[model samples]
Structure formats: C-alpha cells, structure tokens
Target chain A: SQQGEEDPQALSIQEGENATMNCSYKTSINNLQWYRQNSGRGLVHLILIRSNEREKHSGRLRVTLDTSKKSSSLLITASRAADTASYFCATAAATDSWGKLQFGAGTQVVVTP
Target chain B: EPEVTQTPSHQVTQMGQEVILRCVPISNHLYFYWYRQILGQKVEFLVSFYNNEISEKSEIFDDQFSVERPDGSNFTLKIRSTKLEDSAMYFCASKWETQYFGPGTRLLVL
Candidate 1:
C-alpha cells in the first residue's frame, strides 16, 4: 500500500510562476525524498529531507517537512517549461527493515511557456 | 557522475515465454531495486536486492518474478512465464540512501 498521498493530481502554471505540490504520509519516516519523471522515462532524484530536518533548498527548489503534521511540500520557484513533469514523494519508513520506499500518487505539473 | 543503465529499451514477447530485463547499476552502489509502471500509473516497487540477495518484495512480485545480481555490475529481472497483464516499463535502481534510476526497459507481453 502507498504510504503517501499527493494533492492536486495535476497543476498548470506559467513558466515564471512558482509551483507548489503537497504530500501527506501516514507513518513515521526516516526520510522523505522527491523525484521528477519526464514522460515515461526514469525518475531523477531531486532532494531528500531527513526526519530531523524542517526545511532544505537546492537551486530553485525548496522543500519543507512538518513531522508533527506528517506532511511535506515541494516548491519550485521561477518554474520553467522544462520543469514540466511528474513529481513524486517517496517515504522511507522508520520501521522499514530495508531501505524500501512507499511512493505517493504523483503530481503532474505543467509549466507553460 | 555515474548512472544506472538498462538494455533493450523495449521488448516484445508472447505469453508464457521467458524474458529477462537487464540493468547495470552504478559501479560502487551496494543496493539494487526493480520497479515498474503501467501506462499512466504511479511507479510501483517490485523488489530490492542487497549483498546479492533479495531483501524485500511487494505483493505484485510473485512466483513469476525473480531478480539476480549475477556479477558485480549486472542486475536482472526474469519473468518465468510472461502474462499480457505484465506489459509495463521496468526500471532498475541502485543506491545506499539515495537511489539513481535507469532509463528503463519497456516490456510488452503479447
């Protein structure tokens, strides 16, 4: 079963606009990671936030994790048409024996030029 | 930077036939995994391997599926008897904490 659920299954925004996607999970996690997929191709790891962290940034991407609410959000500032793709959040459960990931139903973001 | 690689970008096979999708993970990565995604669906985890053995698998991975890290680099997934329902994109990944994915092999069981 999927432990995380992402909101707004699809989103459309202008190239320079900011895109925000949210994910909520049910269990305690060792870490939460976000990935991007272009079309039907492979996934590209974007960022990972550990349970002890609250926020982190990489380039134009900013991610926030609120353990108390069991929710996380990804914000892509100044989006580009090339940023159009599917975004997924995978939770690494604290209790998972192996480094298994439970992925969320992704958010499809379309950045228009 | 090194990345995972998969061969035979696309494959077609008849039902009940055997098919092996191959992948070569990063040179130094210790953990390996196989995942699949049906058209227009979320990527699903199939199995995870470490130390040349399966560490975990999902319900979707049943008797028909098997994984092996035959050498230090190659990781393969074999479907003993293919089913039409098994048609999907199979992706191989490797990592210790952060996973890197290959372009994936699209398998179509006719």
Candidate 2:
C-alpha cells in the first residue's frame, strides 16, 4: 500500500488564482517533500518541510505540514500556465533507513491562461 | 545548477529481452536510487544504493532487477528477461540529503 495519498485527484485553475492540494500519509515521518512533473517528464523537486516545521515558503510556493493530522498541503500562489503539472507528495519515515521515500498518488494541476 | 542525466530517453524492447537504463548523477552526490511510474500511477521506489552497494529495495524490485555503478559517474539498472508489466518511465535520482531526479527513460516492453 502507498504511504501517502493526495486529495483532489485533479485541479484546474485560472492564471493568477491560487491552487491548493492536500496530502495525507499513514505513518510518522522524518519529513515530507513536494515534487512537480510536467506531462511525460521527470519529477522536479519543489520544497521539503521537516516533521518539526509547520510551514515553509519558496518563491510562490508554500507548504504546510501537520504531523498531528498526518497530512500536508501545497499551495501555489499566483499560478501560471507553466505550473500545470502533476504534484506529488513524498514521505520520508522515521523507520526508513537510507532515506527512501514513499510517494502519494499525486494531484494533477492544470492552470489555464 | 547541476542535475542528474539519463541516457536513451526512450527504449522499446520485446517482452523477453533484457534492457538497461543508465543515469549519470550529480558529480558530488553520494546516494543513488531508481524509481518507476506506470502511466497514471504514482512514482514507485525500486531501489537505493550507497557505498557501492544496495542499501534498500522495495518488493517491486525482484530477482530480475539489478543495479550497478560501473564507474565513478554512471549508475545503471538492468532488467533481465523483461515482462510486459515493466513498461514505464524509469527515473534515476541522486542525493546527498535532498534527491534530484533525472529526466527519465521511458521503456516500452511490447
């Protein structure tokens, strides 16, 4: 079974709108990271938030982690068409050695002009 | 900024044949990993290597699968006698702490 699952399997938003996606995980984690993938391409690392951190920001991207709820959310402010892609949330659990990551099903975001 | 690179952006092979996917990780990175994603499915971890040996592998990585760092820069994944189910985008990742992924090699096993 997959350790993480993302909500809103698909999302569509207009340029300049904010797009938000949520992810839930099954176990305690060392950290959670978000990645973006354009169609038929490899994943691009976006941001990572440690278990102890509640929120983090990088440019227009913001990520929040709520360990108590076993959930995390990624928010893209002022979205652009270039942001259209699949977003995945991966978890690095405390019990996992070698820092292996377990990924979620992912959310597909389509930003339109 | 340096990034991981993968060779043979696409490969098509018969079901019973063997296929090798190659990757060149960032020069200074110490850890290497392979992941795969079936169409419409989430990315799945296949294996992780460090210190020139496999450190961990998922159930999906079975006897048919093997990984090797033949030289200082190249990491390769070989599938012996590939099955139809092996068709997917294979991604190679490297990390010191945070992982950086290569563009991926799409394998189509017919």
Candidate 3:
C-alpha cells in the first residue's frame, strides 16, 4: 500500500503550545499535503510541500519534507483551541499525473484552553 | 474562494440498494476524485476522473462502483449494490493545482 503512517496517534496540548506530528510513506512522491478535518466535517487543505523542497510555511503552520527518508512533518506553532482537529498527510505519487492522494491514518489533536 | 460541493449531506440506505452520490466540482477545475473514510479509519482513494473519463482508480473501486460526469459540471458515484461495509464518509475533491474537497456525504448502509 502507498499509505503513509503517522506518528503519535493522538495528542493533548494546552493552548499556546506547539504541536508536531510526523508522517512516513513507502513510495516515491511528487508532493505531500497536510489537511485538517474537524469532527465529522470536511477536510480543509492546510499546506503542500513538494519533494524537491525541504521546508515550507503558511501562517502558523510549517511543513517539512525529506524525500530520502520518505517522511514529512507538520508543526503548528502556538496552537489555539480552535486548531484542535485531526491532521492528515496525503501524498501525490511521483508517477501519477492525476495526483491521486494516498492518505495516512491521521493524528488527532486536542488543544485545551 | 471556489470549492467543491456535494449533495445529500447524509443518507441512510438498505443493503442491496443502489445509491448515487453527487458532486459539483469547482468550475474551471478539470480534475475530479472520490474518496471514502470509514469510521475511525484513514481516507481511501476510490477513483479519479479527468478529461471526461476515468484517469485512475484504486483496487477498492471495483465492479460495484462507477463514476460519471453526466453534465459538464456534475460528477457522480453510483454504487450498484450497497453493502454494510460501504458505510463511510464519501468526499469529493477537485483540483487545478491543489485539491479542494467538498463537505462529505455521510453514508450509512444497514
């Protein structure tokens, strides 16, 4: 399977703290994306990091990709209670032009105020 | 911002029945996809559509499943015969560069 595996199945953190999660995949990928899903809601695209790039940042979210290791990490700095959700890493295969995303079992995050 | 849209946010169906889930992708976006997540599980890719045809599909997209872009704007997934295992949150996504997903349709097959 091309699925990615996420570390730390769940995390509970206080507001204003940082929350970091890691993802590892077994296949070659063109890019990796992070998404947030609220309980029983739609997935919201958070950020995307191309395999050629090492790190990228958007707002309070930072994403890093290491193709050699086939791994990626997402860091939410100064997390807020509203930032509580499941974080998933999805990868677009290097060979698929259509960009089908293989998702990982997500990390459920809870931020307490 | 443009986003994908799906109809019938929730559906409860009996086993062996056929159900069609609908999605309207963001206009001007050419790629469309269907994915599903069972309760407490990771999301699984179902099928991908591009240029009015299937671009790629996962093994999970078997004979029981079919996808169509009937009009220029709507993409649909038809399950020939629903099974209890088909209960999941079905999500539709579209992309020009980065994919944007629709509010999913929660399906419960009894």
Candidate of highest DockQ = 3
Candidates 2 and 3 compared: the better one by DockQ is 3
Per-residue lDDT tens digits for candidate 1, residues B1-110, read 89999998999999999999999999988889999999888788899998888999999999999998887889999999999999999999998778888999999999
Q: Per-residue alpha-carbon lDDT of model 2 for A8-106, expressed as tens digits?
A: 999999999999999999888999999999999999999989999999999999999999999999999999999999999999888887888899989
Query: What lDDT would candidate 3 get against the real structure?
Result: 0.95
What DockQ does every candidate get? 0.78, 0.91, 0.94
Worst 10 residues of 2 chain A by lDDT: A1-10
Tell me candidate 3's TM-score on chain B. 0.98
Model 2, C-alpha of B4: deviation from truth (Å):
0.4
Q: Kindly list the per-residue Cα lDDT of model 1 for residues A22-102, writing each as its tens digit.
A: 999998999999999999888899999999999999999999999999999999999999999999999989987677888
TM-score of each: 0.97, 0.98, 0.98
Residue runs of model 3 more than 4 Å from their true location after superposition: none
- What TM-score against the true chain A does chain A of each candidate get? 0.97, 0.97, 0.98
Clashing pairs in model 2?
none
Off by over 4 Å in 1: none
